[model samples]
Target: MDIREDLRDVSGQIARLLALSNVFAENNKYWAHLKNDEDFNRVYRIPEKDRYKVESIYADGRDMAIYMMDALAEINFNYARYPTLTSIIEGFQNTWVYGNYNKETPDIAKEICSTYDIDLWSVRQMFKLFKDQEKLLAAVRATLAMLQNSNLYKEENGMPTQEKHPHQINLTGINSSSININSDGASAAVNQTYNEPAVFSEIITAIKLQGLDPIIEGELIDNTHMLAAGHKSGTFKDAYIDFMQNVSAHITVFGAFLPALSALL
Candidate 1:
């Protein structure tokens, strides 16, 4: 098998799991199916199968394989929460496309055999080789650990902080919903504009056009940017609290893994 290609495919799953872990927080929840919500309809396909089973080695009883899986699962779980793993998974998933099979043409199997020097039967075995959890999990874990320990999150640091500005505005609840203008005249008029029923983009544009400086704030969430100029803004502490409440969904998957093992056997 193309070791690198197979490794890459397994790594994709690990990254996905880490992302879920980060969001789920607790191990039990991270393994569950809470993420099966309709909002997660987006699907990512992994890289193509580059190598056949002819050169593949059995991964059973290999410590490396287990270590890899452990590492990958940790990373995948984190990404689900922090989104770092999600971005990495997206990168790997978008990098390759699987091959297509055709049977209508005469000697189709022979043609493939001639080019790849392997028959359809061997190709089937190659695919099965990847099904082994030991190898797949190990490969995933290794990739996850590499990404988790990377400098992306900053190894030694507290919570991530945004750029610190010297000047600060303490407008009392100038949120989009209820803008309380402490001043009269133009300030009140501007505050009213903020409460207008305009789209977020339009409001931002208007604020930029105005002579007074305005700021658009929100959390840079996974694969999305949220506007926090109003009541929409939230604290990470709240997010973590909410995450812990639903962490069990992710953990349930581990129990199901045993059934998968049985089926493979």
Candidate 2:
């Protein structure tokens, strides 16, 4: 076997895997930190060498948790300077160096988060996001694998090449904050203010009892993934219409937003 060509094929599979993982990292609340942890620590991002050794272990369920933690630590450290996400964005630096996630800057992330008293709760949130993202990631990975096995792409050096799938959406960096699901538009409410959902749920019930048809937004059971009321639109029919139209234009856009998937996953 031509090792280079064989490795190329494997690399393609890995890239697709990473892409799916990336989507999960973006969509699923838990995976976001995990994914961020992975993304932020790329080899180039490391200021000092010989800190982290990035390797591809088996892409199995057992390793998922570990990967997620890695990304969480990476993000906390990278974003330590700013208190808010917006401030971090405004002062964004190219820490991800060529998209390589290798360990660097020994205990740098730990030191930074420690200074701010940021604990593993941040990692916990990412795990919550992972729940939903996992489903979509699995679906996409299966689809890609099926295509590759069926010879969908042109073979060069006997490796599967990237193909433009009809349902492709660049979900690499999209986050819960990126999409605005407010009570004014959709019945879906995204609440991030409270640490516990029971309190929020009681508040929501009280609001609903008032006949406001309020859509509450906040961290759901998983704590990382954002959950809203089902897509019923309730008193917000106009928001529902807009949501439907947007979905019709590009369903993949809403793939990550479905309450059904969120509920089941």
Candidate 3:
């Protein structure tokens, strides 16, 4: 069988599963309040016909989660040709899927917030944004498309191909700090001192313009803040590059600000 086609099909299935999970979560806000089957059945009184809806949603989510895990494993088996795509899927699995699928929504939120050092409200907003923007789904589809094109080029030429660097954005006259794209196609390098705060502000503003609130939809803001903090703490440039790579993978809308953020490196 053609592994690339299989990967593409599985990725599409993952997108549909994610959309289903998002819809289930949105419609059942009370899912957050219950902890287990006992709690679920005890907390609410519904007609007999609808009694199984919540249970069914959880069961379906768990089954889909398992399917996603298997798909990622299949992708991982071909990691040499698709390292970037594998990393993106792995990140999504670890952060959003994995052990959280069968659990209550609050449990999922708690785990994410504790791991990322963000708040519960931000977690909820992030999920809402996930549903509205379908960012992760878009990222998976784009990465798969890139991989397929790369494969076609390789096959036609009968030559192995190197992975391309992440897309770079160049900003001129921006405080003399610039990330110069390498002529050899390596990742860019920061050359001068730039206004880090302004760059972060611009990114936050860009996120807010997408109809997210500073206080409510704070997950993206928190992530941007962490990136800023990492720079201030003298973290290496590679860390920022890695973060931006993941950001670009997930949120295509923030493409314009990548260079500014990369400049902080």
Candidate 4:
């Protein structure tokens, strides 16, 4: 599973949504000015021909926004196993895309509405949608940064040349202590004082319960198993920390299990 590819796809979707949002916002600007006029009611009355055109424009933008939101939601569901992506996508949906106007409106949306004198609900909603897209884009970019760093380390170290067996590490009577790992003239001492067997068991059980891909499950199991066998490396530690940060960002079903899983680091 190439996580970077998945994130790139998400980024592309958000970019498209942002462009659509900008167009929608621009279109609404004219209506906003009309709303501020003293003769707004007389000028924009339902009987006016221009009123129907404005309504049509508004409906078109609203429908497109709804369609784009649905696409994002579908992507979120498709990547449900990745807690980080799911959490970010769901946050955008809850707080911006479909949040309640009276109670759940984002602070930025409120501020923008006030600043621009935008009293229209649809315009306010567009502002919220645009802001949400921006925030989610930032999150995805940050996650990609972490993933890229890990990938670069793996490439340079030529680590995991082949998939290791879950039982590859011998765990007979190994005491808890720090181990020095050296690769290509680079070295680091990483602490390995935790109970490896117990931690490995917890990770395996959690992965199985989550029904992750067999390849992913195997990789995770082998890494944990290696750590338990006292093969602690800086690269693995960094990857472990990155995973933990992503998981901890948003509370999910895996929240309770994170602390136990993190002990492997």
Query: For residues 1-265, what per-residue lDDT tens digits would candidate 4 score against the true structure?
Result: 1224445533433333333333334434534453454333332333343344334433443443454445434443445533454444444443323432222233533454455454555545444444433333333333333333343334445654334232111111224333222123322244434222354456557767777678655444443333332213233443343344444422353455545443433
- Please write out the lDDT profile of model 3 over residues 93-121, one tens digit for every residue: 44333333443443453454445453334
Give the RMSD in angstroms, all C-alphas superposed, for model 3. Answer: 13.1
lDDT of 1 by residue, 33-94 (tens): 22232221121111125222122221211222333334434443444423553354333332
TM-score-better candidate, 3 vs 4: 3
Candidate 1 error regions (>4 Å): 1-15, 19-53, 57-67, 74-118, 122-152, 155-160, 163-265
Give the candidate number with the greatest TM-score. 3
Return whichever of 1 and 4 wins on lDDT.
4
Worst 10 residues of 1 by lDDT: 217-226
Candidate 3 minimal-lDDT segment of 10 residues: 130-139
List where candidate 4 sits over 4 angstroms from the true fold.
Answer: 1-117, 152-242, 245-265
Candidate 3 residue runs with Cα over 4 Å from true position: 1-44, 78-134, 152-175, 180-265
User: Taking the tens digit of each residue's C-alpha lDDT, what string does model 2 give over 161-183?
Assistant: 56644322222223333222332
State the TM-score for model 3: 0.36
Candidate 3 lDDT score at position 234: 39
Report residue 100 deviation for candidate 4 (angstroms). 30
TM-score of 2: 0.21
Go through the candidates in order and give the C-alpha RMSD of each one to the true structure: 21.2, 18.6, 13.1, 19.2
TM, every model: 0.20, 0.21, 0.36, 0.25
Residue 29, candidate 4: C-alpha displacement in angstroms? 19
